[model samples]
Target: MQDRAEETRRAVLQAAAHLFFERGYAATSINDISERSGRTSGAIYFHYTNKEQLALAVVEAHFAAWPALVAHHEAALEPTLRKLVRLSFAVARAFRDDVLVRAGARLWAERRSIAVEMPPPFVDWIATVERMLTQARVEGDLAPHAEPSRDAPTLVAAFFGLHTLSDALDDRVLIEDRLADLWLLLLPGLQSCPAPRALLAEVGAAPRARRAAPTP
Candidate 1:
């Protein structure tokens, strides 16, 4: 029974995430989630009290996924800066491919409409980047004039902005290219390494041909 209940809950969260991503908070409804999950309204209500609670669950689960991603790269045997670059690519891919991530991004953007307080976004991410930058500086990968405390927030903001623009422009199909552009422009200033391009290539951050526009 416990396993079945867990299955039901997962199904409901997955359904809610899809709706929340496709339709903003105000537009998404409990019935919509029920329909998507193919579970009865009562079943969904049994797992989540209301739409607000369900939304919170989806966002919380989304936030929960980051630590594991960070850990994966942290365990890797690579330069701190390389790990940082790889982490950004991983996040961009998540934003592009993960329904939960998409839902969380939209929910975060529309937080004002949510009656319950939502978890704050970007605080932990900024701190993570700062830690990586600090370690990179110690490892002699960071440029002499760079300060992790100051640069971390700016880098995080730029990353967030890049995804936002990609979402608005083409649903993030060009996100990797944009990230490559961003690194190409900033790496020289941020890294002490003699070859930023080589570093980007090592991490597979090279830009690719843009996807053709959809036929009207």
Candidate 2:
């Protein structure tokens, strides 16, 4: 019974996530989830009390699987700056690849209630990358900073800049390709500087001369 219940829950989340991604959360109804999951509306309610609750479940799954995604992008690297860049691309790719995740994020943001205890997964994702930037700074991979740790926010800002800018182009692959250049633009004035070989190999590989576009 537990196994069946668990399977049903997973199915519901997967379906809801897809709908939320494609349709946007406010547009996604429980009826939509029901049809997508091949389960009845009662089954969905049986598993999750409401669509809001179901959205949370989808986010939980995204967070729980996050470490593995990080590992996949970073695994082959020898802890170089490129690996970090690859991880950034990996994250963007993950979000981009799964419309459900995108829709779910949209839904959550729309339904955003102060009453909910869940910290935004997007915020948490930024925090995780900030930790990485903090560590890299400590190791002298970034530019000099009075407080290298404080520079974590910059890392998040840079990624957001890249994501928003790249996404606007509608060709995220191109943005992923130019991540190294993006890092260079953002890394200046930081406390530690990563080695050029590492940076070039991992973070600075764009051959096309990029013209600066206005930040969104």
Candidate 3:
């Protein structure tokens, strides 16, 4: 019974995240979340006090999942360059499917320090990106000049820019198809030298985490 309840709660968070991504924080009402998740508002209230709380929890999950997301594109231990390129493609794919992520990008945009006050999930995403960029730099895949600590905001902006363009471009759905072309161009400006294996070794040597397999 406890497990079932926990499952329901997780479902609510995911549904809320999806809704939050599609609708702005103020615009996404509790009713919208309830309806989308196939649960009663009462049930939602059981897990979350209000839309704001739900939004925070939902964003929290997105941040926490960053490691898992980054791990997927790496199939080998010697292709950090390709991994970086693939990461770009993955970002494009995520923005395409996740409406909440799209909305959050706009809402929590790095315009000012004001964005720092966004829901937990938004803050988490920013931090996670900073961490990933830091890792990229350490692996020598990122240019020596790329300052993850001071310029993470810019890196996030570049990623979001790609997402925004992919959406606005009439040929956006096919964006990943031409990802290689863009990656090649980006490669020169970003990396001082190729260091694909460093990334693979890091990802591969890292402790493996066990997760519940997705339900059918």
Candidate 4:
């Protein structure tokens, strides 16, 4: 019974995430979630109580996913700067591909409409970037002028702005390419050392090979 209940809850959350991604908070209803989940209204109410609570759950789940992503990279032996760059790419991929992340982003953008207080967006992200930048500085990889305290928020804002623009223009299919462009432009200003060619290639920012000199 417990396992079945857990399964039902997962189903409901997945359904809610899809609806929220497709339709903003005000447009999505408990009935819509029920229809999508194929679970009765009473069953949803038994678990979620109301649309507001369900929205909050979906948003919370979205935030919950980040730590594991960070942990996975942290376990890898890499420079802090490289980890930060790769982490941004990983998050961009999630924004492009994960329904829950899309729902959470939309819900966050539309949080004012939701009656219940939702967790503030971007604060944790900024903090994470700041920590990574500070570590990069300690590792002597950050440019001398780069101040983590000042730069972290800027980096986070640009990263999300790229996603927002990509989503608006092309439903985020171009997000990874946009991110690569951003890094190619910003790396020189942020790093004291040249970013590894492998790292640049990983995010698709690698420079093109020079054309062979024309035979005389």
Candidate 5:
């Protein structure tokens, strides 16, 4: 009975996340989640009191998985600068590919309408980046003018701005490519000489070979 209930809850969360990602908070109704989950309204309501609660659950589940995602991608193995770059790519990939993360991001964007007093995942992201930037500064990887306190939020803002633009264009499938371009623009100011190409390779950022000119 407990296993069945847990399975039903997971199904509801999965369905709600998909609906929330596709329809946004205001447009996604509880009945919509129930229909998609293949569960009755009673089952959904047994777990969540309302749509707001369900949406928050989706967001919470998404954020809860992030640390494991980072570790799985080996973000901890690299130095701070490389770790930051790798994490940026990992997050971009997640936003592009993961439905739960997509739902969480959308929910946070619509938090004002939802009116729930939950913790924003962006705060944790910014804090993590700030710590990495500070570590990079201490290790002399950052430029003399680089200020971790200012740049950490700037970096996070730029990342989400890319996501917003990608959403507007309806082509988030290429977010990883966009993040690569962003890292190219950001690395010069953020890293010292050499830019740690070794660490970059671990994150799959190795530069492509130059193509030969086509014979006329």
Candidate 6:
């Protein structure tokens, strides 16, 4: 009975994520989710009290699954900057393929409608980038003048803009190319020593080997 209940909950979240991604939160309805999942209204209400709660669930699920996706590619020890670059590619691929991610991205714009204050994805992302930048500074991967505290937010905002453009254009490859171009443009000023041209070239290359598996 417990397993069956869990399955029902998963099905509702999956259906809701897809609906929310295709149509913004205000446009989606409880009936829409129910219809998509082939579950009764009672089943969805069992897991989520309302559409707002369901939308929050989708965002929570998106972030909850992200660490595993990053960890999958980060198993081997590598240069800090290289790791950061690889993670960006992995995230882009995930954004392209994962409906949960798309839902979360869509939900971010509609967060004002959500009653509860959920964990903000932008804050989480900035913190993650800050940690990576701090460590890179410690390891002398970054230039002497490059301050992680200042650069972290900048990088996060820039990447967010790039990702937003990708979503608008519906061309993930273009964002990947733009990110590689961004690295090439910034690395010279950011790296302690001359940035590896090869690293810039390699961004969005073969690193999809650890492509994130879609969350069920």
User: If scored against the real structure, what TM-score would every candidate get?
Assistant: 0.95, 0.74, 0.61, 0.91, 0.86, 0.87
- Model 5 lDDT tens row, 110-208: 899996666666787788778888988887788788888898899999998998888778669667666676777777777776454454576897555
**Cα lDDT for residue 185, candidate 6:** 74
- Worst lDDT window (10 residues) for model 1? 190-199
| Cα error, candidate 4, residue 173 (Å) | 0.1
Cα RMSD (Å) per model?
3.7, 4.9, 10.6, 3.7, 3.1, 7.5
lDDT of 5: 0.82
Best by lDDT: 1
Q: What's model 4's TM-score?
A: 0.91
- What are the per-residue Cα lDDT tens digits for candidate 4 across 15-124? 99999999899998888999999999999999998999999999999999899998887667888888888888899899999999999989988888998888888999
- Candidates ranked by lDDT, best first? 1, 4, 5, 6, 2, 3
**Per-prediction backbone clash count:** 0, 13, 6, 0, 0, 0
* TM-score, candidate number 3: 0.61
Measured by TM-score, the strongest candidate is 1
* Pairs of colliding residues, candidate 3: 21-99, 21-100, 22-100, 59-121, 60-121, 80-196
Worst 10 residues of 2 by lDDT: 189-198
**Candidate 6 lDDT over residue span 1-216, tens digit each:** 999999999999999999999988888899999999999999899889988889888998888877786676556487777788788777877787889988887897789887767776677777777788787887888889888778888888888788888767865656766667667677787788865567755553522234689999
lDDT of each: 0.92, 0.66, 0.59, 0.88, 0.82, 0.80
Those runs of model 1 whose alpha carbons end farther than 4 Å from true positions after fitting are 209-216
Candidate 3 per-residue C-alpha lDDT over 87-200 given as tens digits, one digit per residue, 9 for 90 to 100 = 665666666666555544544553142223454333444565567667667676678776766655655565656656766784367555434444444446566674433332
Q: Between 2 and 3, whose lDDT is larger?
A: 2
| Total clashes in model 3, counting residue pairs 3 or more apart in sequence or in different chains | 6
lDDT tens per residue, model 2, 111-175: 55413445454566566666666666556565555343465566777776676677668746676
